[model samples]
Target: MSARLEVADIFRRHGEAYRQAHHGHLGRVERRVMSAIELCRTAALGGHIEECRACGAVRVAYNSCRNRHCPKCQTAVARDWLAARASELLPVPYFHVVFTLPAEIAAVAFQNKAVVYTILFRTAAETLRTIAADPRHLGAEIGLIAVLHSWGQTLTYHPHLHCIVPGGGPSPDGSRWISCRPGFFLAVRVLSRLFRRLFLEALRVAFEAGGLQFFGSIADLAGPAAFARLLAAARRRDWVVYAKPPFGGPEQVLAYLGRYTHRVAIANSRLVSLADGKVTFRWRDYRHGRKTKLMTLKADEFIRRFLLHTLPDGFHRIRHYGFLANGRRVARLASCRQLLAVRAPETAFRAEPVTDLPSLTHPCPCCGSPMITLAVWHHGQAPPPRSAWNDSS
Candidate 1:
């Protein structure tokens, strides 16, 4: 029942040429990703290997890559993650904020992914914390779960941070839980201005500390004046900081995280066709309210686009800070929950939200209406033995 066009499909078609083109220059991660994708659902990794009882249909089931970049493998990963995080969800409102670099800065970031992207995360976090802690604002310590995304739907380099934030936070003394206004979380305009200033400041520091390198057309930026001019040009353009209303509740926040936390440059569900050495797929046009549409690209072009999002070795895309910080998360979370006076609710966190909700709003694709949950799937296993088949058969 998998409708996905997985990495295995692409690798089966073109991994050999790609490996040949890179050869010894290939990093361990890229090689591993390629190998995993190639072997994903084939007979290489053992599984149930189901066959239809009535028909002669046969299928091979194998293990997943579990590589963070593999789109087809994110569902279970997201569900497991959500289950673990469900305990940490406070009853307070949660907001979604996005910080995006201007095109000029993004160009430089594309060249120095690890360094520039790390700086982007730091500067954005600092900007939010500083602004939120000011006496004029809520004046409390904030927390965030920031996920970095490096590509647009078409796999272009579009680095941005997607933050899932609790609407308020513990006061500096930890006495009370501060809450933001019902609708307004933070000011996008202020966040944008401050983010631009802080990021440029951090970039200058990185350049002076010999953290940046330039080649090709950008080589001239090695000079302070050239870099200053670049920064000034970027400053003249508007940096975008978009903040949306609070996600309705914990369930909604988990649902949102499930989608974004493990997402890759593209997903299997988006691929439409592969024929005649060309690939066709769907992508979102964010510039126009995310109108969905289809696009076609040469096979080589498609591979190139996919490779554009290959992250630097050992970089962590998903991060937790403040209350969710690894060292402090447990204790702080307990205190926060106590302050909020609401215990985390118990639910089927491992199930997909669409499946959990009543199907009236989202009709089943197979039936065009609500579908009953006939069963729950366990990992690499079957449902409990049915009575009729237990002894009679």
Candidate 2:
């Protein structure tokens, strides 16, 4: 049912030694991630037992860790989340925009994730709002959904914001919905300049207010002179901001983000091999037209690179801003519907009772009858003697 190497195999084989070697250095959250991946889908996490009706067959389904960083757990989670937002889709063109951190700033962010990443989110949102509201542009309040990604194809610490935006927005007075030109959203050059200014200014505030810290090579930045120099260097660098062609419909936006929102540093399908304490995987080198290439790294080194992307616990990686803000989303969306001359979604699509929904369980393999759950298995339980049953965590 599966092909290619997986990250789970790597963890199951080498996790204990890696944990012991870095015992004192690993953070609590990192430790939790390791445990979750190692125990995922194994008897260590237990299983669900279902018996067939006519054929008298039995099925055992193991529990998943459901950790945010687990590759195997994201598909179902993404589907459920996207379904919830399906009714919110306005029949408007959508755009995809990316705001990235400059290399010098990225170096600092590599150390201070919580503080710097928060600033990245706030400033990117502010830049979009400011530019879209200018008379030279659309001159309306815009709304966007942004997801944070901290790694690049090569698994380097490259932090960037991926934003799915409507081509236009509601007027400041909320009287009408504004639409941008057919093929253009906003100029990437303009977005880049504005985003750089706002982000650097915010970074300066964070630095002066003692909200940031310097470590290792950047430790000299603890002094005011060094910090100023670093800021000046980052200012001279060109920050990257780009927008893709407008999407045909709102569902396009949902489909695009469903693939992005829940991914980790890498997926198991990309893994090629693990042998001689070295791991090989596939990656895309964007500098060369995104050609696929294989990369090899020591097992410990690969683990280190993976851990670099772990976010501060409880941080919400996906965010909504402007017209889409939760406080007024319903009213704002209602106004958009009126302006666009689209009727409200039918009751079947909105606020339908859960009990009326179709069942999610699997059917009997032979008889097509809905299988009944026989027992709930908990981790660490001593199994009662039974034939044809083996503990599969």
Candidate 3:
């Protein structure tokens, strides 16, 4: 019955002040994010009108910026994406794996977002596929849908990939389904080591190809020696690769994807208050068993923290690999389903009504007759202004 204090509210209240404080220092990404948040769901972008004919109800629907990083827009998009993906899930146990980069690599990823993030996906996928295909492991080509998350609860740059992989896969020989032992999936220790090596190797390749950029505090890392030292440090430390126990069934995987796939740094419901120029919100400390606690941050500081996750333009955070690889996904996935003895799903999930809009027809202003479209107006340019009669006439 009460209003929720959201990150948007904080941005609405103090985003300008924050911008002023960081003026001449804000990166392109952060500046664009500020503009998006302040103008989203406002009249600046124009809108559509929906009128209920039966009930005399009218609603003005504002346009969304449709920025993937915007919290308000991500939910509906996430839901639609989940619905499409739901049918691809096999009717078997699914495992959740997380591949995390060390803080050192996270620093590099912050600097070279598109390149490093792509490397993260490729390396993690390669590690999983290679390890899964080995005779010592499942010896089957597996499928995984990976989603990249760049922020932790407090909105710091913590790059990690979350993957949902089916517990079993078609055997390499194509004779049968290969199932792993119950309660165990891929070996995390092996995954961590392979992930480290592959990611570092890929990073070296990216650097050589001039696909990386360094700035600000990360400028020193542009040198090979410094980059090598960073890699060595990552290898010396334990890379975190965690595997959650098998999910119950296929439907559960749909629910899981709905939450994780398109999540932003924070959600609207988490905030409790915004008063006295301070924002208070609840966050779960995952390292401490999901303990919930309230944290208060100055309004400007809150926006600063929230802006830390503004991704590079057109950067794709989610990726598919192995059997789900782009080019061969259809064929490979069909073979997998046949071998697993599971038929493809009969119907896909639908989160909304498919027929929400009326067919296009111009209602005549004079007689209320429906006017069929004879031609389309191209480029939306107005017709040339008509010329008045000649002066001689």
Candidate 4:
């Protein structure tokens, strides 16, 4: 709740030593993440003075690190993303579907993050579109908003995709709308079976084509025999594909997006304390009735777990598919609104800035007066340039 219990506090106090100890093992991008978290919203990044127009109150506004991994800055990112998505909401019901990789696949994903993660997205989208159009299922072309989450409740490496789909879709012939049964979508068991088959088949193709990498503990899997064994074991197991009931309406879907989009591994609110070289934080023990518990780890270990979710540079965690595909979204959305007989936001209302917008950017903390920017504060160095996070070698 306070600065003492925030992630920045822990990083500021212990990050330098942790970086020094892990110098040889950590990548340049990982080190940059540590540096950004350590200096987030602090005097080190510089600050600007703002003066209240009515009361003459002066306030110093510190610059945010704006790193995607920084806990303090992701809130704004989530807000902006959700705001953009608000108008894209359809009048029909929405469903939440999840696609998860098994531990064996997750191990390979750890080494080949960009490749494996991209494969995961592609496989998931293909499975959904393929099954939903089989004539036995919905038989409509569904739209989905998929988000990639790589961490479990305790910050463990568990790669999964969270997909928000419409309950129905446009007909295959694009002649008319097709809607699923009320409060029901595709069957989860069928989805899981198809998803497992498609992903394993694609993984086999990537392996035979020399697209995947292996190293350290998994070096043996690079061989054809070892890789076949891996695939066989994965095939025998049931891949998890969880589907929840449809959301009540568009408002509920927007509320759900606020939580997952652009989220970091851990939030500042969960941190309880950092003392005696151990950082204590609240975590959910999902296996045990979802019990609330406290977990403490050494300073170095804490930082290590936190950095495990840092994505490869330019790797998009959130992806769109089917009707929501990025290239076709604008035209498809406009067509969908017309077909569904719903009005777009701009067409429904006049375009004027909301009255409450100013409170977000320029408001006096002391007096409720409008605060104006006094001067711009420039940092000593520019933010780190985007580069590849790891080398294949």
Best by TM-score: 2
TM-scores, in order shown?
0.82, 0.91, 0.87, 0.91
For candidate 1, give the lDDT of residue 319: 85
Worst 10 residues of 2 by lDDT: 351-360
lDDT of each: 0.78, 0.83, 0.78, 0.84
Q: Give candidates' CA RMSD values in order.
A: 7.6, 3.6, 6.8, 7.4
Candidate 3 — which residues are off by over 4 angstroms? 356-393
Q: What is the lDDT, from 0 to 100, of the residue 7 in candidate 3? A: 65
Writing each residue's lDDT as its tens digit, candidate 4 over 277-385 gives 9999999987899999999998888888888898998889999999899899989988888778888764231233446532234668788877765554557644322
Q: For residues 185-228, what per-residue lDDT tens digits would candidate 1 score against the true structure?
A: 88899999999999998898899898998877798998889998
Worst 10 residues of 4 by lDDT: 384-393
Q: In model 1, how large is the Cα lDDT of residue 251?
A: 84
Model 4 residue 51 lDDT? 68
Clashing residue pairs for model 1 = none
lDDT of 3 by residue, 79-190 (tens): 7787778767777688999999888789888878888888898899999999999979889888889999988887777989999898878778778888888978899999
Cα lDDT, model 2, residue 237: 81
